[model samples]
Target: MMKYLWLGLIFSMAAFRVMAFPAQGGCKLAQQHQITGKVGRAIHNAAQAHVVVRANMLEASLSNAVQAGVLSYQQGHKQWLEVHSVRQQALAYKQGITSHELKQFDHKLDRVTLYLCRH
Candidate 1:
């Protein structure tokens, strides 16, 4: 009877361990998914920061252009507003945006950059 009770106790302990630990594959997959999510979020944040900083720098350049008479105040203000809009959009989206949309914003900035640098 004692031997049977001891055997049952050991069996129950083993069962408890199996239930607690779970299968390694499932656990590892969950961990991997979590890591992927974190990495994606980090990349997205970095992209937003990069775009916003670029917009700010471009705005500064526009200010300098206006002051130097390379561009008129009217034109500069318009472009400045555009840059602000782009920066705001970059800050707004939580998920990754399409490259086409990014290209459109970059192309607008590039147009201004080229005009400012050339003249």
Candidate 2:
């Protein structure tokens, strides 16, 4: 009788452990998914902030270039219109412009547009 009780207790313990494993696995998976979602949100927010800062910088640089006589009124006006269009699109989509394109515009404004302007 003693041996039979011991065997029953051992079997119940084994069954309990088996049942607990799936619950632990589910908890771990849930935690991992929550962490991944938080990380994704952080990345998206950072990207959006970067886009906003770049757009503001580009607008300020264009205004400064015009004020410094590096660009003609007509050229500056045209560039400002382009910037406004990009800003509108970015406001709508949150990622309409890229750093590479912004760099290209900056380079053109610095080198080509300045060269074309009269003193």
Candidate 3:
């Protein structure tokens, strides 16, 4: 019984570390909810709220990924550059964020977190 229990535990831990492009299997369902929930809430919040939230998420996620060895510093930095660009554009908009801009922000962020699962 102990042997079987140990094996199950090992497998479960390995399952979460997987970094698959377009995440698949059971992990997808779990990550989709956490990431999507934030996106949903951001949509209803203030205009700057969505942009700020997602920009921070991208920076933090990429930074963590680099530290975890899931992504190299160069890879993480490249994405951070994009995040900076999005934030800058949003701030420059004298007018409140538009629907298309919001979608763009979400779309870019979705790409960044695509492979990440709760770690």
**Per-residue accuracy of model 3 over 3-103 as CA lDDT, tens digit each:** 99999987865553353223322235344324422323324435556676657666776675676566778887887788888777766666557777777
Clashing pairs in 1: none
Best by TM-score: 3
lDDT of 1 by residue, 3-98 (tens): 999999888766644443122222232331222112244237545555665676667767766765557899889878888888787667777546
Clashing pairs in 2: none
Worst 10 residues of 3 by lDDT: 20-29
Global Cα lDDT for candidate 3: 0.60
Q: TM-scores of the models, in the given order?
A: 0.55, 0.40, 0.58
Candidate RMSDs in order:
24.5, 26.4, 7.0
Question: What are the lDDT scores of the predictions, listed in order?
Answer: 0.60, 0.45, 0.60
CA deviation > 4 Å runs, candidate 3:
1-45, 115-119
Which lDDT tens digits does candidate 2 get at residues 1-119? Answer: 99999999888766654443222122242331222111132224433344344445445555655665556678767776666665454445444335565444334433432332222
Kindly give the stretch of ten consecutive residues in candidate 2 with the minimal lDDT sum: 30-39
